[model samples]
Target: MKMWLPVVLVSLLLGGLPATHATAGTRSCNNNGIVVLHGMPLVTVDHKCVQILCLNGLPMPKLFENANSGCCEFKNTLYAPGQVFLDGCVKMTCEKSKWKPVGNTEFRCKRCEVFNDPHFMSFDRHRFDYHGECTYALTQEQFSRTPNFGIFTEFKKCYAVPSCLHRTIFKDNPKLLIGIGYLGLNAPKIYDILINGEKFTIPGDNYAHRLIVKEEDQDVLVWRQGSCIRILGSNGLTLQQCTNSIDIWAHPDLKNKVNGLCGSPDDNIDNDFTSRGKQVFDVEGFAPQEFAESWLTPPGCPAGRKKGSAKKNFGNDKMK
Candidate 1:
């Protein structure tokens, strides 16, 4: 069953009525006439300048007006800024805040849409929707909070992401160890890298320090060595080495290796991009649940450790 709270409570939160019952704001207008606030044309037998109060279920102006100046009675609906509601396919949103009700001013609400494309994944009420085709994360953070707008209706915030030029690959099972295409010098400045279920953030400023991918060079291998992952460049040059879930994407080619937590990166499958990697929009058919357990593991030991230890190992890392 649909339930609703009393409007008086809403008014309290809105700070609509005065705290005390003082007749200071009221004065005698028409002699033998009802008493009311000085300028307002409300007719009341009691000389109370107190603002008229009404609850949600009560009807309009007559609730607070006397028979004499009942024509002056007008009801208003209050709304706060950033609140969103839907009026069918078009959405309505309050652009500003209004605590107390005023007369005749129309409430202006902007209109919006729920879906920009049908091919995109379905919108999840609780979580953000990823628009792989446009690389936007549609969020419900901006939905309206106005009373009666809707508990379910949500306005969206389309967040732009960096380029998704790489593809995806998998080891024996695509669920647990998912692979991103090989990384190159021209990789996106910002993107998502998920290992298991953990995410790694690579910002624009540290792109040069965090990534080193040779264009068209398949000799270098990027793989998950058990709990630790590493990027093996030419001449056995270790571009990057860490044991935690690695968060970065690259092309589909190069090679992939999976080793144990204490195992070397060299022992694993060499899965390269057999063809062009799938784009974001094309992934709707592939369910996200197919991925195995996504755990939040700490990063593997530091890269370039001496004798495969978590010691400083990037002695020859050129800051390209």
Candidate 2:
């Protein structure tokens, strides 16, 4: 259930509503009655999505953009340039104060509260205790927040990390962990052949329930769904001899779902992915329930303290 959030986000980002393209030098914030904003999704005024005031969901307009000038945003066109907020807090302030960084990159500024919850502003019907949420110590060592868009890279680059790459290639944010591939003994020969733009060769032999690899990106170029995984014999991609479901593709498969306290990213998700790990996907990969209990636990302490292995351990001695 938690894994489905990333799927919802993908659909929103890719399926952003169509808006009029702006002309050179002049960006019509009020483009023919439609409000648009920079770095935000298009929210039609008077749309059912909003309920507070008759003003409707405020559209964050992209004020200016160019190869030279990246992009600038105006907050509802209300506060002018002179007006400022207390650093780290969004409330208005006459003096400059400390500024809080949001997420992994130095993209957007946030209030002390939004600093706690990136997904909190989605504010819709779903609201959680962002201030109380705690990130894994490992993540805190490597990144500021969930290495999300606007924060990392010039834009959102690491968003498409592979399953193996999670907690490995990136900042080891457990929230990004999505189990892929199961070690199946009798699990047939190849259940799914996940890939990006790059094509990989699978060995001809027994079957596999899932395909898992460690990489940094998964910008899918194309997929051959409704096809079966077959032995790469002299015939090349022979579908007739395909024996496994992972090999014999009847249904369309997507990508793994992201799980975390922050808002789900805007991207496509393949529901086939689950958080259950290999037990469900690869029967052979199953371990004793007792062993699985302490799977997420670390053997040592965090990076802050010198030799305080007994100092702090997440999920173990949090309250103490």
Candidate 3:
């Protein structure tokens, strides 16, 4: 008998899929390193900006095509609303993990990822991710150098910063789309796609990257990790498929879904530095096991939190 294998795809729509009750936020992220996804710098977060999760101590994928860790690799059962990058998604549930938090969107628990994962989205399609890493402060800098956003120090030296983590790919071929990271914007701007170098923004929304990739290769790394060129191939390269970034769903719901929050990693700016009844790390100090379906957003916002009305005042921008 002859064996027949079908070609896989590497594309994500980033929207319109069943929500996993997945809620991601961070009362504080360390002001240190950076992580690069789809050519964008995911700068180290302040203690009050947002949260990010990664799996460490695991084997790296040999080829870009094999970089898929799946959902089981997330360290500890860190699944919960307001929790950044909840783990253990496979054969997992909000009720079983007691992940869902009160007043939080069900999608927090329901979603695997609006986008692909360096941990959960494995490069080794056949292998399951065993370890993970959540980047903070200086550690994030290992990924890249250039950042769309930047700041000046008291000494007047210029510094780069990470504000968003986004990437895109094509739906048909792996060589078409590419990932682009935006550091800081002069003002709120919308997202659009460029077909053959043509600019095409989403019809109703401008959350972030559109997340377009090949369905068959969706499990692999269609796009590279650091650079944001169209994932499409050129030269001896595929000539135009796309890079891997968002999950297969990132596209279908691209126009309606929230693309996480966007904020400046400016340490000089004022952020919720203290808490009333709780200490600063109390939010991060909570254990996943201690979390329950009922436990939701901490009692109140952190102290010195940026103004809720004028986000830009504190050098913050909440991207919904």
Candidate 4:
């Protein structure tokens, strides 16, 4: 039998009238101005296929399953669980009580993260660490095709550590370039940003077709959510620069179509160690230091020592 909680709790919250003095033969319940005889069912006005039972001088609501029951409501329409519908380009499913996306909804992008000790998580969810301190391409379109874009990061010795992320650059092919530079160890909260080689202040204006730059508390956010960048397709991209970490995300259109230290997100972790020179390294082998070195920015920049190197002075010389 279908069971339900007593409606007395709900009635109390709605400021229900106090229970009338009960005699042996006059036991009944009044709900929404209707007198319900004991053990009789009353259908509520708001819900379908559910009934309220007057029992013991109180109203108890219960849900019953029928041909029209166990369905979800959306805009006054009922849909069976697991029913799929489309709202524009997005496909949604009614799951018993709520609506959920079916697949590849907006904001469903692949993520690549660079965090403490400069560890890396690729777009395909492969995790690795590369401690080389040099500017490197974090991710970019395959073969640097036109309408291409690239996210790069420069690692430097900071707080005496050999490799710490100190700068991030997002280049949208031929024209737009955004650079985010972190202040030195003593004053890490301050940031120096540059747009197309000119100094850019915080809370900057949104570039219509490119990206929006905003400062939130201590971190700076650069994103293209609704605005479509050709390389990222519709879902767009987002980059968050925190104190010592950088987080990046690219739309699903970039899957299997990108190459860098972030790897090609083809859903296969085996080839995630592909080097800048198009060489694939064995995932089970030793750390691919050469793969990391090949992505060094400027084509000929010197590589920084691994994590075990002697601590440096962390002065202006190390910031480059």
Best by lDDT: 4
Q: Which pairs, if any, clash in model 4?
A: none
- lDDT, each prediction: 0.22, 0.20, 0.20, 0.53
What is candidate 3's CA lDDT for residue 1? 7
Cα deviation of 128, candidate 3, in Å: 8.9
List TM-score per model, in order. Answer: 0.15, 0.16, 0.18, 0.51
lDDT of 3 by residue, 175-208 (tens): 4433222221111121334443555433332111
lDDT head-to-head 1 vs 4, winner:
4
Where model 3 places Cα greater than 4 Å from the true spot, the runs are 1-166, 174-190, 205-246, 249-320
Q: Regarding TM-score, does 1 or 2 come out ahead?
A: 2
Per-residue alpha-carbon lDDT of candidate 2 for residues 27-100, written as tens digits (9 for 90 to 100)? 32333465443323342111111111111222232221211121111221212222332221112211111111
Which window of 10 residues has the lowest lDDT sum in candidate 4?
Answer: 215-224
Cα displacement (Å) at residue 238, model 1: 55
**Model 4 regions more than 4 Å off:** 1-107, 144-147, 182-192, 204-235, 299-320
Cα misplacement distance, residue 49 of candidate 2 (Å): 29
Summed over model 1, clashes come to 18
User: What is residue 135's positional error in candidate 2, in angstroms?
Assistant: 9.1
